[model samples]
Target chain A: MTKNILIAGFGGQGVLFTGKFIAYGALIEGKELSWLPSYGPEMRGGTCNCSVIVSDEPVGSPIVNEPDVLIAMNRPSLDKFEDAVVPGGDIYIDSSLVDREVRRTDVNVHYIPATRLSTERGFDGIANMILLGSVIKGSGVIKEETIPAAMSKVVSAKRQNLFDFNIRALALGAEVLE
Target chain B: MAEKVLMKGNEAIAEAAIAAGCRHYFGYPITPQTEIAAYMAKRMPKIGGVFLQAESEVSAVNMVIGAASAGVRVMTSSSSPGISLKSEGLSYMAGCDLPALIVNVQRGGPGLGGIQPSQSDYFQATRGGGHGDYHMLVLAPNSVQEMAQLTIQGFALAEKYRMPCMLLADGTMGQMMEPVELPDSAPEMAEKPWALTGTGLSRKHNIINSLSLTPDELERWNIDRYARYAKVEADEVMYEEYLTEDADVCVVGYGIAARVARNAVNAARAKGIKAGMFRPITLWPFPKAALNKLATTCRAFISVELSMGQLIEDVELAIRCSRPVTLCNRTGGMIPSPEQVLASIEEAAAKLN
Candidate 1:
């Protein structure tokens, strides 16, 4: 089945990087994928988002009109994209930033305090990865085992010391629900 | 030994150009296409290739002409407005019969338009953006993978015809990322016998001049160039046909618009409407004959684009209005959704009845 995923947050929230990691995981699993960002001026502030498609077949459109999974890292992102999730799809809301309840009944909603938990653990900049960890567990779109290697490939060598932190963040995210 | 790695479309084009033996890149920075220049700036130096950022788009195109005349594979990239600035240099390159690759990662257009994805440059790209009676072999890539593949093809075609070739992508294709298998080695470059590499005393000097003092001589040059363009048209038409067999409506588009149209075609089919898509991979050669052939079978045609019916005109001309040709388009940087295209397809299907 094809999975249309949308990840959105502020400009510095690693919205694009979160999408890239999932895209890389999809690639590692030999799935066809496309990652298209909200480019130009719209990428400046809290409205930044990216559309990702992971499919067994070739993707028709990189732009996701109604996503199967919506990862909203902020209140504005959740408000803007929550309704666009497909019926019976999944929506992950970063509860620390988004206090509003999900208004949809047809889909599953997981509210994780990604920012609060990450900051408590002293991993300030990788709340997106923590949310991504929940996304992997919540959606089952990709295997959890595939993420570390994908993260290794995506993170540059200069930042290699943060590799363990990112991996730990992913594990912490996965434990949010369990 | 092809290695698959995820890369943004602009970076893939830069790497693919290097793999195609392109040793020189000259371009000014522009939104949506700046990544191409950025990638070249970072990688070209390490590979011993020349990557010079010109003061303006005009100078960049002129630098391409200069480098290409020296018999090296050279390229430059820009967006819609910058492309307009480079038009004069493009016409000059065409007149001189130099080989160069020009990539237009098109954004909204006319003059200083927004940096959103747009196909507004369709007319400017295919119908000779530059002055004079010259044509550029325009390759339209819909995906990041095609962005890499077509850059290689663009360089080869430019060398083969001794003419400038364009990789006509848009902001969507430029910024998107996908897993692409890069070529293991640079393709073998064609020898340039008439190149203006220094003439040793043993050989006669070759002049690279577009200025023909005599009108008759210029006319002769134009005629010869037209003949070569005709050969390119006959041999290099590229397109992709999806579910065209026994379809009542054929949707035609290219670049990112084509990808959106493909989804519309599938959605239309799901609703029991006979729909298909004809994607022009080569926008200049246009795959007109293939489209014309489909017009005989399909009940009608819908030209989908991110411009105000730029490609539709060519679609009508190609089919000679034999089929009812209609347009489903969005202009000024708006991308039409699959539902929007489906509405048009359904409208076109209803018109047939």
Candidate 2:
């Protein structure tokens, strides 16, 4: 099975990091994958996005035009990419920042209130991970147990102290879905 | 021992060059390819290798010429505009028969274009970006793994034929990250008998020069170089074919566009359109024989590229126009999606009727 994912938000919202977390998870699971960033002037304090593919077979195109899953962390991202979701696909939105409702009736829309949940839980600045947790639980795209090992690979030594907080964010995000 | 790690294409190419015994690197910073220079900057010093950021692309290429003339493996990397600045030095390298590696992680073209992915430099890379009848051995890598493997191969081929070799990549290939298992170590390089090592009365002093003023002597020199080029053309053509056995339509592309075209081919096959793909790995020695052979079996062809129509021209010449050929392209730093390529394939298949 192939999972085409598009993660979008503002530059400082950890949009690219969310995609990298999933890409690393897929890599740890021994799956073929690719992570391509929308890299240019837009990456500097502006809207940014990345396309990630996790597949059993070799990934063909890393640019996801019609993604199977769209993770929108802000209002602009949700409005911009909602219609591009494949029919019967899933769209995960952060309800705390994006007050707008998804107009697409053909897909499953999950609003996680990621920002409020993360802030209340004392794990601020990691709303992306909470949304990622919800996607993991709702979509089951990767094994839940594999994420910690993947996180170890992604987080550098200088930021090692934040590993525990990130793990909690993932758990809290998954709990919202439960 | 070889280990599997996730690496971006530009960083992988830099690491691979270091492992390939490339100790001297000279380049100016450019987008989509700056990671290569950055990596060399961080690691080259630890290994006692020479890494110099020249004042400009012109100076960088000339520095490579100087290093390569000293009989050591050397390299330089830049994006589209920077590469144009190095064109004059490239001609000098070819004329002097110097062995060096030049990497062009191409961005959009025609005078300071955007820093997005593009393959518009196909003509410049394959047809000798400089002047006076020369061909650089050009290798186009599609994936991150190939980014490393092909850099190693580029160095080997450059030394083997006493010519400059180009690793032609694009912004997409330079930025994407994937799992790659690198080689255990750099391969052993061959000895350079024509190197300008200072003669201490042990051997004849060697001279590396491109200024053959006499027309007759320059003509003879050009003939000798063409003979070597002919040998490389006969020997080093690399490509990949997917599902072309009984297909009526063949999709041709290279680098990232080929990856996109493969997905389109698979989609067309699901619709029973009988489509396949032919990807050229070596752009200069350009797998013309394989394309010519496939032209006999396929009914139509679609050339998918990120440029307006650079590679399609080569496709037309390769098949000798025996079959109908069409182009599906996006330029100015835009990449064509699979759906767009699939529509082109359907159109090309419909033309068969």
Per-residue lDDT tens digits of candidate 2, residues B1-353? 48678899999999999989899999999998999999999999999999999999999999999999999999999999999999999999999999999999999988999999999999999999999899999999999999999999999999999999999999999999999888878877878989988898998889999997899999999999999999998999999999999989999999999999999999999999999999999999989999999999998999999998889999999999999999999999999989899999999888887
Query: Model 2: residues >4 Å from true position, as ranges?
Result: A157-160
Query: Where's the lowest-lDDT run of ten residues in candidate 1 chain B?
Result: B182-191
Q: Model 2 over residues A2-57: C-alpha lDDT tens digits?
A: 99999999999898899889988998899999999999988555899999999999
> Best by DockQ, which number?
1
Candidate 1 segments exceeding 4 Å error: A42-45, A157-160
At residue A126, give the lDDT of candidate 2: 91
Candidate 1 lDDT (Cα, whole model)?
Answer: 0.91
What is candidate 1's lDDT per residue for A1-178, written digit by digit as tens? 8999999899999999999999999999999999999987764464799999999999988999899999999998988988899999999989999989999899989999999998899989899989989999878888988977888888876797798889889888999965
Q: What DockQ would you assign to candidate 1?
A: 0.89
Backbone Cα, N, C clashes tallied per candidate: 0, 0
